[model samples]
Target: MNSSRHYVIDFDSTFTQVEALDVLGEISLENQPDKDERLQELKSLTDRGMGGELALRESLSLRLDLLKANKNHLAPLIDVLKGKISTSFVRNEAFFEENSDHIYIVSNGFKEFIVPIVKELGIKEENVFANTFVFDDEGKIIGFDKENVLSSNNGKVEQLKALDLKGDVYVIGDGYTDYEIKAAGLANKFYAFTENIERDKVTEKADHITPSLDEFLYVHKMNKAISYPKNRIKVLLLENVHPDALQIMKNEGYNVSLQTGAMDEDELAEQIKDVSVLGIRSKTQLTKKVLDNANRLIAVGAFCIGTNQIDLEECLKKGIAVFNAPYSNTRSVVELAIGEIILLMRNLPDKIAKMHEGNWDKSASHSYEVRGKKLGIVGYGNIGAQLSVMAESIGFDVYYYDLVEKLALGNATKCNSLKELLQTVDIVSLHVDGRKENKNLIGEKQFKEMKDGVIFLNLSRGHVVDIEALKNNINSGKVNGAGIDVFPSEPKTNKENFESSLKGLPNVILTPHIGGSTEEAQENIGNFVPGKIIEYINTGSTTNSVNFPNLQLPILENAHRLIHIHHNKPGIIAHINRVLAANDINIVGQHLKTNETIGYVITDIDKAYNIEVVKELKEIKDTIKFRILY
Candidate 1:
């Protein structure tokens, strides 16, 4: 390993968990009703495995055109981004105090979003290298620096070569650009971080595959600069995750294993015998029994959005943190929704079917324009909220219904009840959560309340609506056309055959739950989700944590520290301090926080503590688990 000590990290899918550009586009074009088609196309290209640089170029151009996105649009986008910062970002003030000089963010993504995030991480503006955006006199976003080397293909390697840093250059990221640093021989070591997207090419080329930055520091003996092989993480790639994910884990020096095809609970348990990190998609059913057998499983990777496949409660009981791709596929799902809305209004599905059967039937009277239509949205979370603004921009009078309060955007109106929204809107879309109570939420009664010939879309969850009821509603002419993406009982693997109840209906659109299946979204997903997982495992940071104690801190240097996980009770901190005081260890710095059930404390001490302090700290009545970081 080259001993020169500087590190470079990617932004999109590498630092932030989602593509900020895509999120900005969705938020900015809330008033444009005509750019939906282009948005869909952009999302598709990204999901199909387009490189981040290319995906950003196409998507950014399309969004900027639709948005005329200027400075005014940027403030709201910044708010959205600030609220959605990465979970692994070093937020500890002390950690930043120690390591700020060595960390750098090198990205092809826009400087607008990157600057704020880096500033939050305590990295100075001078430490960040990114593409700059240009706005016209009208304040409309025009273009980026085409001449900037970082924006070009292989730009990361070129940028690093120009840096001429003293120490070994260590690159961490989830894209081909980051991998190119290693491939080009500019960096001494490249870490393939799968916490975001796992590219086969990048993983195959990486020197190490790290799930998180914490893992990287731990492996290098850097955090506290101590070496211990027992702390080495062993990862198991179960069914459903891409092969690239496994390769990256192996490259990272993890004792990695892979199990192909589906397995029953017993087989799954047997396979995870020694696994510490379990990676899976929707296929693998991580039941309580399976989890009970996994003595060493510390984490679960639900590679997809919906976590219904995994037993979250069971995992939590075992202290296993779970991570999923929530916003990674937002653009893909929104694009598909927009396409379906246009298709359904135009009666394109039926027209295409007739044409394919060699029937030349031309009827414009039955087709209507998407513009000037009423669009009703249910469960205004990430996907629903995004679709709302996009639909409104396309001239659709947007009405949304959510159980919880949501901030209104553009011309979108909020209906207090689902019934009220259904009766008033021409198109009804489901984007609710995957809660059990949501099953059959939009069955016959809700459909009956909808205006006759109303368009319907279900891009959320299969269980959110009754498929049989939806099919019946279409037959009775209560609904004009429908787009159904997700299903209640989808086949786990790509190889498995899928059967659906809403198979053959006139003017009905059936997609393979591909609302988020665009190449852009998938690559973002592959690049983003794994990065979050990796960051969490590496840094003990959990800004986007679905479970476990949430601790945010600045990056820590080579100071010996004790991380204590305990029951969130009163006096836990005092007791921890007492133990340290009794051991006579000097406390250089300390930070403490608590979630629902657990309290986490990171105490930086002078690098000469006896092992007895750790032993005594673990014996505290409230302490759940403890580890030393040195």
Candidate 2:
């Protein structure tokens, strides 16, 4: 708190998020037939006045005449303005309360509206310099006080000179008149406040363009609630993950942008150059080249279930945490598996095709019920386990096999090996993951081991099963009917055509990969994945991170939290503590977790410290990434 430094802030579009006169016009002209036209005029006049195109006196006169607002409108207008305070200002309320003596509300607006709003923030009423609204005998608006210097052109500069604010005056505002104070040599610096609005003419003349009040406080090393503002963290969400995800990130105050579809490797690499957080579905690939170009990336969120499209090993080496929705869409994929099994078992694809061609083949030639069928589920993961229980309830004897041992659910039985499950079941549904070892796990040899005329389904990864072998098996009648939702090759967008060997086969149900594509499943995923990423970012909690060690961090309070990700080697944690000890940084609490390749350590220390400590910590050997969470 530097007592010599004075802060002069504007009211409309700077302290509050809206123009005052425009709101007043809406309130007073509510019953008027020409309310829309009057509101438009009020907005236009405000822009011209703020742009320095119109005199302040003339602007105020015309706006008041247009408003025709009585004393009653001022009270309601104050309530609305209170709620409309700039988000950044609301976050730093403590700073304003502590520095009330040095902070002033200097605007060309009215004191009746400005004082009430600033009063709640601990601003002194005498420090507020603005015009006074004169009223008639009936309490209707008539005019303003002409004697006040704020009602004239260049009023802010004239008013500041009269007050003679001492030492290093800083002006934060969105209008050209606010910039006039600095231009007239009354203020030291002019910051163009753009949290609510950005005027080109005003920002072009500013010494600094502050996106939020937090940015200004951060630069000045003031005692603020946040060490780093969320508005500085750039989040790029691609493939149109979900609207809920977008809203969630925005509510967290991040600079979030959304792209409708996934980008190719080259396009993604360029777009990720400066992005701090990247969100995508399965279509976007996070290759080595793309990750290498991401100079500022901190986390990658796989909004879908599988992380096969991302290079997990590379992400680990780069100290980037990766997350995915492992169980959010499980029920959706399981329900789709059951529906597809019934459709393929009844040979409905061929029958439905014939019906479309006007051939009324009302014959149950090969249609069979699935009540007593054996349903074999490969890879007993979330989707697999859920499918097992659901299939058992549908009167099918469920059998499952996985590389790792898993407990059987309900009356379902676990197979000892893949060969054993293939030989026994009538319907084989692949619910495996996207590991490289699982690619082409089912080829011609495995298909041959399955019972003849068996039904097959692959709703998992595209490359898990050899498509050519499955196509030959279906054609030879060894597989009576099949449902293949995934393939080795697919189109990136819906506008492109898809071609596969399984297509045009008799009794084969070839669907585009849409196993988990339900409105409910998408919404569930939208609610879960972004929330996890937000948790990891806000509290350094990596409980469900795929590529990082799991640590369920508690919320940080009354201290600064520092996170360091480095190569997993001996003496890394010891060296970090040594550096902190040398800088006199008292560690309040500390947590360390490590994997085979990377070590993550979070340290909480006293809030008071030098910024130079960060540079020393980064200079340590084997350091990958470092960040401060305050």
Candidate 3:
């Protein structure tokens, strides 16, 4: 051992966002007859253990005994735990890796779970001083090892003292035992790590309270400070964003508030005032007046592919960067389109509906095979293109039409116009972008031209098609079956009554815009867009931005970076340098870019400058926003 300063981090609620035993009970006793009761009991046991209200062994033994689990649940439990790690830890893997020799996990959580997750961070097995599980001959969990130090009260302190550890030791945790480490002089300082949960008894006596790993790293100056306290930067994620996206923003240290569904413009406007980062799906509309209320909004993350819901021009004028995951959910949407096509062709909807109603009508009147049928795809974009390749691979003839020419994938052919595509194919699926010009692009005239009994699917914008015309076609048997994912207007919440023209119509599949609702797709989008937003926040990057001028700058190590956004007028760069020169803060290097409306500049300066320099930059004319980053 190097005999240097050490950091003993907690496992549950501190290093990870959830208590291990609680999650374990949820998974292990998932199908048990007393699931709810056992879960509550396990939670109580965890509370008592962390509060130091009971001997650690008693709590561990009791909770473990209540577990009806065997060794089989460990693998899947670890997978779930992998995603639940504290956001700070996920973002700062390098810090833990580089300082693995000095960092340790001291907790009453089981080694079976904790060891596997933290080991991925380069923490050694021997250094992890957590309780170990004892299993019976049948692999059922019996209890924990009675001799493990963490099984006893004040185990972390006892273990650290036994190690005869040298130098300053900091115990970063969220439980009473973590504080006891310092109370016993086993550690120099106790930092109450509360990225997940906070306990008052432990927090009251802590030398420092850290909400995130980045906060701790920032306070020690071991790492450069981010733009702001992540927790202080308010993020309003609307329209039921995936928990993963919310988790990512939380990981970056942003204060995040979530609304499970979309809100109306007035309610959204009311919620926009204090938000710095606003994330929404396709439904929440951000009008000019709504943008006006977002006084502190710096970025908007369109969690879906389309940005039509937001006021892009207004966001640009406000120096706010807008980002979207145009390709992240493409496969998901395409797969849904393919599945809907197959269902429609096989008359599966009617068959399933009749089956549900106890009607045994197994006739092959409307049913047909998708193979050897021509699938006309409108707007050959990400989803349409992917669907083309997959459809052709499964023996369907593919034809696509777009305003702009796109290279045909596989044996798929491109039609010159939407008319030719409609006249020729057996089925037509729309996948166009939701720009204003695309509104009513398909109406009665387009429907009139399609062959009778032609299947139709619209996975794009609701306004792109005239719903009344679609209902007419289905009524006249001009279209055999229709699958409509998007609607011109949808209810703000799940409890609201739905009103649609095609409701209760025969062979019609009217869905609530769930084209990309798969677990994999949401997870991908949740990971993709927030990373871009955080990139723009931390490194002044706008690589995938929709509104702002595109620019990306790497981290300026051991230096302060000045980010200035201004109106795209002449002499801004010169004015900025003049201000820097007057303040005697030499600019080591700078990067500048401009578009039609704004100028963005990233200047690295000597870290020795004071607040006056920052004040002068903010006072400059036409400065939309000025931030000092370290």
Candidate 4:
């Protein structure tokens, strides 16, 4: 509550999430036949005014004429605005109530609707200066007061000049009129509020562009609901994960930077020095060297299913939580495997190529239907199990083999060994994970056991299948046709060329690891992985984290929570408790969990503790990281 500075805030698209006049048109023109067209025109006028393309006076005149709104529409518009408050503003309602004396709502809108919205926020009615609506004898609106300063162009600058005070002034808004006050040298600074809308023209003239009200409070070092502002946390997203994911992280107020392709270890090390959250798909490799350079890295979001590309051991030691979408894209990979099985069995790739070459032999030489063919699924996990059910539904007798015991789905049989399943089936589809032992799981010895003319598929990890062995088997006619999505090695980006020994084979179907590359799967992964990353960052709840021990924490209420990560050794918790005891800090609650390598502890204490307690906690021996949550 800086008493030396007066705060002037905007109304439409700043305090509320929408333009008040645009919404007023919707309420008043609900039953009109051309309601949509009128709404479009109203929105255009609002944008033009906010963007400085039209004067505020003219924009308001045209919009009011089109709205035809009367006194009857103001109440409903007020009610709609109550529900449309900006999310950032709604969370910081206390800030407005505490600083009611110095805060003012100055806008080009009418006081009829603005008063009701700001009244609940503890804003004094006299402090709220805006245009007053003039009503007719029958309560139908005619026009605004012509003498009101807010009804004219550059009205905010004129209005602020008339209310001359002896303190520094600051303006926060989304419209060009808000910046006009500062341009005239009436205010010390102007902040372009982009929580709901960002006018480029206004932002270019602003001293600072705040993504939300929280950002404004954070920069001023005011007491806010969050212990730290999200805008300060640097997030780097690479490998072109999904637009939905990028938008979600940006809306969360993270300082996000995106790169469309993967980066090598040295390149990533240089870029990851200050990044708090790192996002990637399958291409980028998070090795020990890369993780060592990430001094501020707290979490890594793998947008794809596998975590083999990331170094889990180093992540655990460094107190970095890793999250991956394990099941969101399972159905996508299963569908691809089923489709590939049918395509390779019917020999459709060869026939399609022949047709494209202008040759129409039209003979069923080696084609076969998948109705009675035997289907063997290797490594029956989430994708493999769903594939088993789908393959069985299409009339194939399914068999699966895994090192770990898994229940058979439908009427599918479980094989005792890889040898038994390989020798027994007409088609072998690999669906294993990316563990080191699974590399080259299907090689020369395993392929020799498969039935001759068998249709084969590998939609799993690239290193799981030996490509040369499969090519040799195809040449020997032991395997008639094969489908492979993953490869032994892939280029870092789509711009690079792909070379493989399986290329130019007669009936081979070679795809560039597109088993789970569907739009739907990417969207689901986009929704899932970022949520986990945000959860871990905000509440220290590593419920779905792969490297950290699972901990699901409740929301903090009326207290400050201290999160401490350290090595899993004796007397770690005792040392933490001793530090709190010596500081005379009263503990509300405590939680502790540990894996083989690291320990995580959360301590909730009363807010009255001195700030020096945080310094004492970090000085504990073997402490990896410490943070405070409110």
Off by over 4 Å in 1: 1-231, 238-252, 257-264
Q: How close to the true structure is residue 80 of candidate 2, measured as C-alpha lDDT?
A: 90
Instruction: Using TM-score, rank the candidates from best to worst.
Output: 4, 2, 3, 1
**Angstrom error at residue 493, model 3:** 1.5
Model 1, 57-106: lDDT tens per residue?
A: 55445545654567777778777777665543442333344677877789
Give a tens-digit lDDT track for model 3, residues 76-157.
8899888888877876776787788888888888889999999877889888888878888999888888888788887887
Estimate TM-scores for all models. 0.63, 0.89, 0.71, 0.93
> Whose lDDT is higher: candidate 1's or candidate 4's?
4
The local lDDT score (0 to 100) that residue 437 gets in candidate 3 is 97
Name the better of 1 and 2 by lDDT. 2
lDDT of each: 0.74, 0.91, 0.87, 0.90
lDDT of 2 by residue, 276-345 (tens): 9999998888999999999999998998899999999999999999999999889989998999889988
Q: Write the per-residue lDDT of candidate 4 for residues 168-271, one digit (tens) a residue.
A: 88899999999999999999999999988888899999999998888888888776777777887999999988899999999888999999999988999999
| Candidate maximizing lDDT | 2
Candidate 3 Cα RMSD (Å): 9.3
**Best model number under TM-score:** 4
Minimum summed lDDT over a 10-residue window in model 1 is located at 222-231
Error of 3 at 119 (Å): 24
